[model samples]
Target chain A: MNSLMAIFRFELNRILTPGRVFWWVVVAAFPVVIMLLMMNYLQPPRGATQENINTFFTIALYFVAPTVSCMLGALLIAAPAVASELEQHSWTYLAVRPNGLFHLVLGKYLVAVVWAASATIVGVTVAVAVAGIEDPGDAQELNQDDTVVAATDDRAVRRGGRFPGETATDVVPGIVATGEVGRAMVGLAILSACSYSALYIMLGTLFHRRAMVLCVAYTAAVELFLGFFPAVINRLTIQYRLRTLLFDWTTQSDEFRNSGVLDFVSSDESAFMQVLWLVSWTAVFLAIALVSVHVREFTSASETDV
Target chain B: MTSEYLIELDHVTKLYGTVIGVNDFNAQLKPGAYGLLGPNGAGKSTLLNLLIGQLVPTRGTVRVLGQSPRNNSAFMKKIGFCPGFEGLYATTTGLDWVTLLLQLHGVRSRPARARAADCLALVGMSNDMNRPIATYSRGMRQRIKLAQSMAHEPTLLFLDEPFSGLDPVGRTEMTNVLNDWIGLGNSLIIASHVLHEIEALTDSFLLICGGRLLASGTASEVNELLFDSPSEIEVDCSEPYRLASVLMDRELAVSISVEQKSHGGDTVRLRTLRAGQLWSQLPDLITRNGFTVTRVRSADDSLQTLFNSLLKIHRGEI
Candidate 1:
């Protein structure tokens, strides 16, 4: 326990260098910067209703919350945690301590999760605040001829479309709350941040020199490609589970179905089960990372010459 | 493995793929101070790594403190290792590095900080302890490495090439500190290619070459291995001719060369197979000739000669 805490503190101090903090701040504000640009320059064609604003906010959350802020932030911080130590020839000194390798991995894992989650939260909060300022709730009704066109991924735009099934007198209105969406986005960001951090840390331990390369390949193969496929393999990815949970937790499902685009993927799983799947994946990958560090050889010669 | 020895390696071998790091090595080191003498690429670093449990032997067993060193926390707790490479967080200060290492050894934060300060001071690094390691010179970095190892005060310490980057004064200071540590009855195994530096630290040594142990004994005993080769001695005297005549007459000298000194004396270098015989007969030779012997120095009494002789002996050449 003492060794774990000491290594945890040490890893945190080592990572909180001045240059690293600057890059993190820049990454965290990227989502907010994009939102500001769209609000001022794009303007949604002038006759846009509150439903269009809600669609824009939902699309923004899909991109910035999970894809950009969470994934990129976790990759930048966690992918090099162990690889950097090996490259700098500092692994041997720490490896001699009792259970030092285990503590080192755990400590760095914690730092990456906390850092990435916080950055994503900051970015999401700013984007949601800007979304409200752009289209405050005065116009919640959609015109019959108004087409809700969104960013790339036709499925995502279909998911972000306005609902047509709700009457004006319905107690639960058709209008999406930006703050509510932000809360759900926050939960997704935290879960994805942890899951990505765990997976990348495992990759780092498995392929010390080529960790980043493997990470890129994994993202392209699993998260980006298989995650969107309407098959059983898609369920293996955290993206699939996160998307399922997002629809279940918020009013987005009712809005998306009424928008007239049907999803083949099953949304029958409870929010609790999807969250459990994500947590389980995190645990399994973290366990692999810990076990790899313990069993692998990280000599100075292996790191430098070979 | 026996409990009497702090470190035991029985026919241990470490192979890095087809390359041999340590070849059929065998040694049992008791609790004391000893130098690991070898040149570069002599497997000193590899052997030290094995001893510290960083690398496991391929074919044999290694035990420290009567237990296996591979992931043996109990054994590691009583041991400290300072590697040959510069293994430090470049952005951190010396104090921070040492304190973190101390805390990893299970010391609390407050005590680790105090112990780190004391160890840095012991290595003569108190003034610059707070500076980032990136700004430190090669010598200061070596000192900080040593400081981190010593901060925890282990029962046994393994230091590889500890005197590599030290200047003369710094070497002297480090030597004094190591001597004090030994004076306290803790064991130390210091590795260095330079024989004189090892000679300055400890009287006992282990001579290794090509991943094998060549010899192990006291300084005098190792030097005695060079007796088969002609020992070179330099003599400064007032009567060079007379001294040469006496040495030649007794047949005590195998070869001799004389150079006329500009300061009204002669300098003669003599090579004799039997230095002991010549030394026993030196007083009579000098007194009989009434020669004023200002200096008598042995040229073959160096580590390089001892190592050369040890290698030859290992090959059965002498």
Candidate 2:
């Protein structure tokens, strides 16, 4: 445990340089910048309903904060954990210590997760605050078409048998309240960071020479492609669990929930089950990474020459 | 492997694919100081790596402190290795780097910091310990590497080319530190190609060439090997021809050649198998013949020549 904390503290200090701090700021500002741009240029028409605006913010926040920001942060930090040490020829110094390899892997993995999660959480919070939620009074005025209001009311009732004004604080003009969605997005962002960091760290240990390339390929083929395939394999993806949790936590409209477009997300699993699955998969990846680092031989190019 | 020996390698061979790294090497090093002397690519680094458990032997076993070194944490705690190459993190300060390494050995933060300071000071890096390593010179970097290796106070230390970047004064300082280390009853195996560098620290040597142990003994023993080998001596003299005749008459030389010098003199170069006998009889022969010898020097006094002779002996050539 002491060695693990030592590695963690050392790596944290090593990465807090000016160059790394600049990149981290870029990652954290990404979602906020996109949200500001969208709100300015893609605003709803003068008489447009509130459902369109809410959907835009919800989907945009989900993709930008939880998906892109977290994925990029984890990829940049975790995928090169072992490769950087090898390239710098510093592995021999640490490898000679007692349980050094194991602690090194675990400590770096934790730093990656924490760093990526913090960036995503900050990005999501700032984006949500800047793209302010729509007031129900303004929605009632802009949504002038009586047919659209009745349809929204029916959808809200189907969602949880609660009208918009019946419980004004609990229900927003759209499917769920802004506070509930913001909390759920933050939770999902953290989970995304943990899961992706674990996967990339495992890849780093298994393929030190080509870890980044292999991680990108895995994300493209398995996580992004197979995640939306509407097959049994989709359940094996982190994206599917995250999407399921999002839907379960916010209680989306029944029509959208039953729609065949998002058939990849499992409706049967509860939110707790999805969280358990994600945590279990993270543990498995971390276990494989620790084992690989412990058993495999890693020598620098010069050492190999000797 | 018995606990009596600090390190034991029994017929150990390490093969990097078809290339041999260390060939069928066998040694039982007791607790003491010894030098690993060899030319470049002579398996000195490879032998150190094997001893530190970085690489496993292909066909034999290696034991350090009476236990297998491969993945042996307890054994790791007892040994420290300073590699030939510089492997420092460029962003961290010398003190923090050493302290962090000590922490990896299970020392707490406060005590690790104090120990790191002391080790850095031992290497004469007290003032510059807070500077980032990127700002350090080659010699300072070498000192920091040495400090990290001994910070945990291991029972045995393996240093490969530790004086590679040190100037004369720095070299002397590091030699004193190492001598002090040995004086404390710690075992050391310092690897270097320079004969005098090793000679300054310890007389015991493990001579290697072509990934094999060619010889192992004290400096005098190596000198004895040189004395027994066929060697050449060049003598600048006033009467080279007469000296050559006298040397041949006494059978002190196997072959002798005289060359005319540009300065109106001659130099007699003689190859002798019995160098000890030649040296003993040369002054008397020159005095009796009234030969005026200006200068005399041996051509086979370097470590390379000694290694060549040992290699020949290993190959059954002489």
Candidate 3:
């Protein structure tokens, strides 16, 4: 435990350099910049209801904050955890200590997750604040005749109890509740950080020589490419689990279902089940990373030639 | 009771694909200071890696402190290793880097900092400990590497090419630090291709070549081998023929030849089995004959030449 904390603290200190902090600022401000541009150039129509604007900003937040910001942040931090050590010829020093490899991997994973999560959560909150959430009573007054309200009411009646979206609005009776949207996006950001950091750490351990390239390839192929198809394989990805949780928490499932684009999500699974899957995948990736670091021979480049 | 031997390797062989790294090596080393002397590509680094648990043997076993080094954390805690390569972080200060490594050994932050400071100071790095390592010279980097390795005060320390980038004064400082370390009664195994560097630290040596152990002996034993081996000597002189004739008559030269130089005088080159005798008698012969000798140089006195002689002896060629 002491070794793990030592590694964690040391790595965190190393990550806070001027250059790295600049890049982190760029990551956190990305969604806010995009949201500002979208609100300026792509204003809602004159007759469009506040619900439509809320849904648009919510989806934008999901894609930019949890997906882009979190993925990029985690990738930059975690994908080079072992490769950096090896390139610098510093692995032998750390590998000789008791539980060194295990602590190193876990410690770097924690730092990556914290750094990525903070960036995404801050990005989501700033974007939400910039886009502006209307008062709940005013939004409800304007959304009284909207079809989304009717659909939400129908689903609530069918489910025989209040769903997450309805319960989220008990204090504010509107579709675009600031507290609910911010909470859900922040939760997904944390999940996205944990899951992606673990996956990238595993890649870093297994293919340390080409860790960053392999991680980028895996993210592009498996997470982005395969995540689009409405197949069983898509169900196996963290993207699918995170997206399902997003729709469930934000009450956006009915809208996607009506549009026939909900085929990729396992709607049959509850939000709890989706969280369980994400957590389980994180555990599996972390386990593989720890085991790989333990058993693999990570000699210096010169020694490898010998 | 503690184990009798600090390290034991039994028929250890490490193969990188088809190339042999350490070829069926065997050794049982007691706890003391020893040097691993070899030319480049002689598998000294490979053997060090094997003993430090960075590489596992393909055919045999390695035991350190009576325990297998492979994945043996308890054994790892008792050993420290400083690799031959430059492993310092460029952007980090020397103090921070060493302290962090100590922390990895389960030392608390406060004590780790204090110990790192002391070790750095011992290596003559106290004044520059707070500077970024990127600003350090090659010798300074080497000193910092040594500091981190010994900061934890392990029971055993393994150093590979510890004198690679040191200047004369830096080498003296490093030798002093290592001598002090040995004075503490801790075991040390240092690998280097330079003979004098190892000689400055320890008398015992394990000579390796072509991934095989050629011989193991003390400094005096190695000197005896040098004395017995046939050595070539060249004398630049005004009277090459006279010097060659005198050397032959004195029975110091097994073979002698005099060659005409392009400039002032001729040069006399001779092969002798008794170089010490030749050196001792040459001045008297020169004084008696009044020969104008300018320079006397030994042709084969390098470590590579020594290893070649040992290899020849190992093959029964001498």
Candidate 4:
């Protein structure tokens, strides 16, 4: 336990370097920057309904929060966990210790997950604040007939949940509700960060030179493509599980189901089961990383050859 | 009790694909200081890696501290290894790197910090420990590398080419630190190609060539292997013909030849099976004949001969 904590502190110090921190900051604020540009420059219709604004927030959470921000943050931090050490010729020093490799992998895994999660959460919070929910329409129109459906039938609502496009007074409360959903999305973002970071850490351990290439390929094929695949293999990915949990937890299954975006993501898995699967995936990847560190020979002479 | 040997290798051979890194090596090291002497590519690094448990042998066994080193954490805890390569965090301070290493060895916050400071001081880098390692000179980097390995105070130390790039002063400082470490009664096995550097550190030596152990004993044992054949000596003299005629009748001179020097002078070259005996005669011959000699060279006293003969023997050539 002491060794793990020491390695944790050591890895934290490594991650906090200026070069690494710069990338971390860039990834964390990316989602907010996009939202800011969209709001200020693109200028959504001045008369846009509160439902339209909520839809925008949901879209940002999907691409910006989890997909872009959390992913880049995790990839930059975790994908080089072992590879950087190998390049620097520092692995022999750490590996010679008792339980050194195990502690190092676990410590680095924790640092990557926590660092990426923090950045993603910070970005989500800032983006949420900057992109506050626009006021819903008149209170008397709470029972408005077709305008609510018409107002909420955009891409964002189609991808996520139905927006309550009622009274302008309901705007604040509805916006507050959306904020709650956004918070849930942030939680999912953290979960996905840990899962992805764990896998990348394993890749770093197994293939020092090709880890980043493997990571990019895996992200493209498995997470991006296979995630939208709607097959049993798709279920094996963290993206599928995270998306399933996202809709299930936020009570947006019906909304996205009524629309068509949830078709490929259709799964009846409970939130508990999805979380269990995601956590299990993290554990399995970490185990593989530990075994690789134990089995592989990282000679200090390798640095000279380079 | 565990095996008394600090390190034991039994018919160990390491092959990287078809290429052999170390071949048919065997040794049993006790608790003491020993020097690993070999030219480059003679398997010094490979043997060190095997002893530290960084690489498992392809054929045989390697045990350090009576335990197999491969993933043997308990055994590793008792050993400290400083590899021949520069493996440092360039952006971090030397103090930070050493402290982290100590902490990784299970030292707590304050104590690890203190030990790191002390080890750095011992390596003569206390003043510059706070500076980033990238800015450090080659000698400073070597000192810091040594400090990190010593910070944990392991029982057995394995250093590979630790003196590679140090200046004379820095080398002396490092050798002193290592001598002090030996004074503590802890064992150390240091690998280097420099004979005098190894002599400065330890009298015991292990000579390897072509990935095989050629000899292992005291300094004089290695010398005996070099002098096993008749040694050739060349004398550049003003009266080379007279010296040659005189040496021809001497029992110690197995063969004698007189020839003109390449530049312009005469030279008398002799091969003596008994160099020591001939050495006594040379002084008497020079003084009695009132000969003026420009240079006396021992041609066969080169390390190349020993290495060449060892490799040839390994190949059954001689």
Candidate lDDT scores, in order, read: 0.78, 0.82, 0.83, 0.78
lDDT by residue for model 1 over A17-106, one digit each (tens)? 888798678768888887766555554444545554566557566677767778888888789889988888788788877677777888
Residue B200, candidate 2: C-alpha displacement in angstroms: 1.1
- Candidate 4: what's its TM-score on chain B? 0.81
Q: Cα miss at B24, model 1 (Å)?
A: 1.0
DockQ measured for candidate 2: 0.52
**Can you give the lDDT of residue A13 in candidate 1?**
86
Which docking band does candidate 1 fall into?
A: acceptable
> Which consecutive 10 residues in model 1 chain B have the weakest lDDT in total?
B222-231
Deviation from native of the Cα of residue B243 in model 1, angstroms: 7.1
Evaluated at residue B224, the lDDT of candidate 1 is 66
Task: Give lDDT tens digits, candidate 4, residues A1-306.
Answer: 787888887778877878988988897789778866765554334444445455545655666788778878888878988988888788888988888888888988888888888888888777766665433333212344423433433433332223455333222212324566677768888897899899899887888888888888888888889987977888988888888777776544244457777667746868899999989999999999999888888774443221
Q: Where does the lowest 10-residue lDDT sum fall in candidate 1 chain A?
A: A166-175
- In every candidate, what fraction of the native interface contacts is reproduced? 0.50, 0.63, 0.64, 0.58
Off by over 4 Å in 1: A37-56, A133-139, A142-175, A253-255, A258-267, A302-306, B233-254, B259-268, B272-298, B312-318
Q: Number of clashing pairs, model 3?
A: 0
Worst 10 residues of 3 chain B by lDDT: B219-228
User: What are the candidates' C-alpha RMSDs?
Assistant: 6.0, 5.6, 7.1, 5.9
Candidate 4 colliding pairs = A137-A167, A137-A168, A138-A167, A139-A167
Q: Residue A11 of candidate 2: its Cα lDDT?
A: 92
